[model samples]
Every structure is written in C-alpha cells, then in structure tokens.
Target: MVNHKKRRDLTTRSVLIVNFNNDLPELEKALIPLNWECASACDLKQSLRIIEQKNISVAIVIIQAGNELQVLNVVSKLQHTTPDVKWLAITTQYPIPSPYLKKKLATLFIDYYHTPIDWGLFSNSLGHLWGMSKLQIESKKEVREPTLPQELVGCSEPITNLKKDLKKVAIVDNPLLISGETGTGKGLCAQLIHAQSAREKEPFVIVNCGALPSSLIHSELFGHEKGAYTGAERQYIGRIERANNGTLFLDEIGDLPLDLQVNLLNFLDDSSIERLGGNCPIKVNCRIIFASHIDLENAVAEGAFREDLFHRLNILRIHVPSLRDYREDIEMLAQKFLARFAQDDSNLRFTNSALQAMLQYDWPGNVRELKNRVLRAIVMAEQGKITERDLGLKLTNNNMPKATPNRLRTEIDTETLLEALKRNNHNVSAASRQLNISRTTFYRLVKKCNIQW
Candidate 1:
C-alpha cells in the first residue's frame, strides 16, 4: 500500500467499484488522497443502478478465485448495457483461471490487477481510463451533432411550407417522391430530407438516373460480381448497397429505362436485390427518395413509364415550386449568390435596375440559372455595382430581343418572348401566333421559362 501526505483535487472524477472486497478500503484510502470519489456495490444489479444514478466513467470489478464465473457473467451484462463506461478488473487469483475465462477477462477489461497490486500503477490506470472516456464522449458528440450545409436559402411562403413538410416527413421512414420542373432543386430537397432524418449520421448517396449510361445503369445500381461482364476486373457494390442504413437519392427517376424500372419496383416491394450477375439476393436497408422533373402520370399514360412503379414511388410525395412561383425570394437569393461569388469584393453590389430586371425576367432555369447569372456577372462586372446590362437584360421598356438571325431556331430568346407577350397583352393565343409557334410549343416555352403573367 502507498500513502501520500498532500491531497490532490479530483472531486470532478468518479468511479464505481463492484463486488468490492477487504482490499477495497485500502484502495479507497489510497484514492482519497487524490480527492477521487468512489461508489461501491456488492452485486451487479446494485452496480447497474448506481451507474445509472451517477456520472461514473470508469468501473472496477473484483473477482474471487471460485467466483470467476459469477463476476464474468455480471461484467458481460454491464458491458452490454453501459458500453460507454470503461471497465477494469481486480482478481485474488490469476494463473489458476481456465484459458477461456482468461481470454474473456482479457478481452473485456482495459487492464487487470492481481492480488498484491501496485497502488501507483492502479491509480495511473484509472486516471488514464477517465481521460479516454472523456475523449470518446466528445468524439461521439461531434459526429452526432454536425452543422449541415446551407442549401435551401429562401423564406418565401412556398419555401416555408416545404420546410414544414420536410420536418414531418423526416420522422417517418418511407420512400419519398419529389416532382418539379427542371432546375427546381429537387436534389437539394432530397439532401435536406436525409440530413434531417434519424439516419443523418449514415451515408447519403446520389444517383442521377438520366446521367448514367443506359448500358451500365443496371450494373451501377445493382452492382456486379467479379468477371460478371466484359471489362469487369473486380466486384462492384452498387449505389443502393453503399447507401444501406441511410438514404439513396435517385434524381431524374423518370429517365430510368422501362426494363430496369421493373427491377427497381421489385427491390422496393421487397427490401432485397439481386446483383447483375449474382444469383443470391442481398438485403439492403436504405430509404429511397426519387426525383423527376417530368410528370410521371403523363409518362405512364404515354407508356414511357410503368404505372405500377409510378404508383409505388408516389406514396410519399413533395412537389417543389418553380422559382417564378416564389418571386418574393428572388432578390434575396440573388443577393446571397452575389455574396457567395463576390468573395472578398465587399464593395460589389447589385444595382436597383439589376434587381428590377431580375424580377421582371422569367427565370426558366430556376435557382440554377439565377446562380449561374450571378456568378457570371460577378466575373464580368467592370464597376463596383452590377447593372442590368451586366446581367444581359435590355434596358428598354419591352426588353425586346436584339435581332440575331444566326441564333438557333429552337432556342426561344427571353427578350423576344417577353416583347411578344407585352405586344399581345399577355394573351397566350396571340403571343403564340406572334412568335409563329404552335400553341402547345408556346405554352411549353412559357412553362420552361417560368414566365408569370
């Protein structure tokens, strides 16, 4: 036994001693000089209750020669229930234990001490365990509470409604379908849902169905065994497998080939999938979120998409509004993008005329287009203030298009369309005639451009 004349301050530290024996008093006496607090329990049940009631970070279990089995059983239960609590062991007999028992003890405890323990070494080990426990707690806190990226930047009514819906949907684990026009940030909405979900700490994988090559879409989604196909060098784990225990965001889901849609539907029906070449079914636990700009109902009717698959995916739906629907947020969004792109150029500001032009012009490309224009203007603007001209907007009242005969015939110029609309007093039929395009084509352009009357 060792003794110290000077008492060190360690009131903040706590340890639980289970099955304490005659040696416990000596240990307590040694710890008291270090100002360490100790709680003792005669049984595992009592120890568990004490652990729950106290903020003890370390536990020391004492084992007698014949009571090894009892002590080991109790320690195993405690280890499962309170994994965060670091454990140490003290035994009266050492070399007499069975090999299995010895292994079990070694595996469970950070360190073990036999009879005639070194008091100095035991004290240092306890301090080390406490410090390690603190570090692990801090690390878990950082992982569980992360600062997510800022993607949704608007406070408009539509945006507010969307946020409310997201909060409600996040708590429930189900397949979500997001429908909107192109560039409406459906992918971002998927990301927001996953970030707020219970599985936030898990993986969030994205797959652009439209971007993947038709020949490889199946392989990419369902993975492939080694030598399953030509040019296959090694086994591949698909996106769905990669997202297990988390979320799988499939953007432009409408573009998935009809043949593959059936396979996807089967996977959705039963949370299991068969790899491209493998015969065995692999179970995957991932929340599926699908996004499509095209109308799935129309696609189903046209035989371009499967009706059953469409209905299955449409169970939990969210429709993101086009940028024009929330015009109130355009200025704020523009300013936010300006700040992002301007960087250290603090003096850079959008002119009143530039803001007015942004409000008046139809943003067909939605938020994506706005971001692009703002980024372009920041690089192109010569003066401190970004003007309407810098954003490629005509200063005239009608904002008519400057004639460009060589421009693509399929491309509908913003100025030309706006001038036609103004000339026809926003009459859809007359505007279509003025542009010399069919009514359907004209209306599509209007919708595509996000033109608002």
Candidate 2:
C-alpha cells in the first residue's frame, strides 16, 4: 500500500480501470493511497463511454488467466479511439500464457505487473507516465499554436473571409470539399477544420489519392486481406477503417481514378466499407474532408470525374484564396516566413525594393511559392537584409498598381492594423513585427486610429 500521507499532499488525478476479472473493488482500494479518482468499466463499450466523458490520462487493465485475447481486443479498440492515454496492465498469471499474447501485450502497454503487487514501483511508474503525458500535450500546443485559423498569418479581406468560412464549416459534421489552386494551403485548411471540430481529439488521417498508382490505389485506400492477392501475408486494415471515429482527409481527390471514385462514393453514401477479400461490411464513423487543386466541375463536364461524387462532397465547400486575391498580405507573409526560416538572425528583414517587387509581381504559385522564395532568399541574402535580386524577382515599371492618395492609404493602414492586432491576439509587439514596423510606431498608429486593445 502507498503512504496515506501522500494522498493529501498531491492533487487528485483520474485513472480508468479496465476491469475484466471482477477485481474492481480490490484495485480501487489499492489506488486510494495514491489519491487517484477511479472510473471502472467492465467491457469495451463502457470503457469507451467513460474515456469520452472524462479526461482520462491513464488506464489500468486487469487481465485474467484465460482472457488474454478478450483483454487484447478491448485494449486495441480503446487505443484506436484515444491514443494519447498511457496504459498499464495487471494480470494474475506470471509470464502470461502464450508467447504471442505476451509479445502483443508488451507492444501495447507502457508497463505491466504480476500478482502480489509492488505498490512502490507501480506508484513511481504511474507518476512518471502522468508527467510525460503532460509534456507531450504542451509540446503539441507550441507547434500547433501558430497554424490555428486565427493565427494563420494573414489579415486581408479574402483571408478574413476564408477564416469565417472555416469556422462555419468546422462546427458541422459534413463532408467538406476544399477547392483551391495547388499550394494554396487546401490541405492545411482541411487540418484546421478537423482540429476545430468535435472530432478534434480523434485521429486525422491523410490519403494522397494522386500519389499512389492507379492499380494500387483501390487496395491502399480500402486495404487488402492476407493471402487475398500475390503479396498477401497478413490481414491489413485499410485507411478508412483506421480512421474510424475520426477525420479522413483525401488530398488531391481529383486525381483518384474514375473506377475508384464510384467505390469512394459508395463508402460516403453508407459509411461502411468492404475489404478487398473480406465479405462482411465494416462500419466506419469518420468525417470525410476532400481537397482538390484542379477544377472538379470542369473535370465532371470533361468526363474525367463523376458528377454524382462531386455533388456528394460539394455539400459543404470552402475555397482557399490565391496570393493575388489578397495581395495586401504579401509583406506580412514574407516577413513571417523569413522569421521562421532565419532563426539565427532575428534582425533579418526584406529591403524596400524587395517588398515593392513582391507587390508588383503576380504570384502564379500562390502562398507556397511565396514561402519557398523567402526561404531561398534567407539562404542568399547579405548583411541581414533581403533584396529583390535575392528573391529572384525583377520589378517592371508597368506591373505596379497605381498608388493611392493619403486618405485612401490612411483607411487601408487602419484596417490592416486592426486585423493584425486581432490575428496576433492583441500583442502589440507581435503585431508590429508582423507589419514590419517598430513597437513605438505601432502604438502611435493605434492611438491615432483610436483603436483600443
């Protein structure tokens, strides 16, 4: 037993006990001294419900002498739904019964214990696992924070409109079609939608329909059975089945072969799939998000894509704006990209000529092209500054847009300032850097525009 004094010293933590041997009372008592709040479930259904209802960080599976296979299925199902939680298994039999079962157990559990429980060792491992889980969450937040819709590095009207559409599509559970030019961040938009939806905690699986060959695409998306084909050896789960109860993002969906499109349409219609060699239907409850760079409507008219399938996905649609559509955001995007790529030189900035060249040029490749150019410039720039030559852009007198008057410029400046502030979470310093202005100048403008943050 753990020391009773430790219970009052630490904050209470939640743990799910997957009890299969009717040992719930004994396990609950054993966990008392560690100050754990327990939620016990006897089967897979109950366990899933409790995990969804409560924020469970850890789970303890009690495996019986003859119930290894039953417990394995339960653990595997739970892992599919919630992969973040750390699992620990306890069994009455030592060395387990079968070698295969023992091997599978080793792969699934963080730690396992035999009967005559060593409370001291178990308590230490539990605490360490909890600390590790917290660190992993904090790390993900640091990486994902910058890419969240609100912080998406643009504040122009087109970008603002795109953000609004993303929010609207996120709250609803519908098949979404994201249309945009190649490299316009359509896949990123799909990820943002999944991150903001009710299925945020579930897996977000991506399938590049264009990357795989036509002959192998069908088996790859739907999976194949062992010995079902020439290369068959073991039963393989398909992408759709793996994404059960989560979000599935099919990138470059327009490239999917005409024959495969009908199969995809059938899956979308019934939310079920049949493995290549399997007979029974496997029901998958996952959100489908499709992204395409080409014009699907044109493809339909040209007989390359099915019109019926297009309509199925076109129910909830979002169009990612091209770089030229939001030209005002170029400077900010370039500066951000420079800051990200030029990590060692925080003082590095684009010269005025470079900014003018970027403004004058029509971006044929959109945001992705802009990012690559900035990265290349960082490698070629001199004396902590980037020039037009470094960005491989030459300015022509005829390409520049006509200059605006003082009144119009002032209105544009005010609107840009407000959007920058909102996008940067009202952090004046961050917003100032985004606009390539000094903190003092940003504050003066805020006061001049009568903007309160």
Off by over 4 Å in 1: 1-148, 395-453
Q: Model 1: which residue pairs collide?
A: 364-449
* Positional deviation of residue 363's Cα in model 2 after best superposition, in angstroms: 0.9
Give each model's whole-structure lDDT.
Answer: 0.77, 0.78
Q: Which 10 residues in a row give candidate 2 its minimum summed lDDT?
A: 141-150
Candidate 2 structure quality by residue, lDDT tens digits, 251-341: 8787788899999999999999998998888899999999887688978998979999999999988989878778999999998888666
Model 2 pairs in collision: none
Error of 2 at 414 (Å): 39
| TM-score of model number 1 | 0.57
lDDT of 1 by residue, 305-336 (tens): 99999989889999999887888899999999
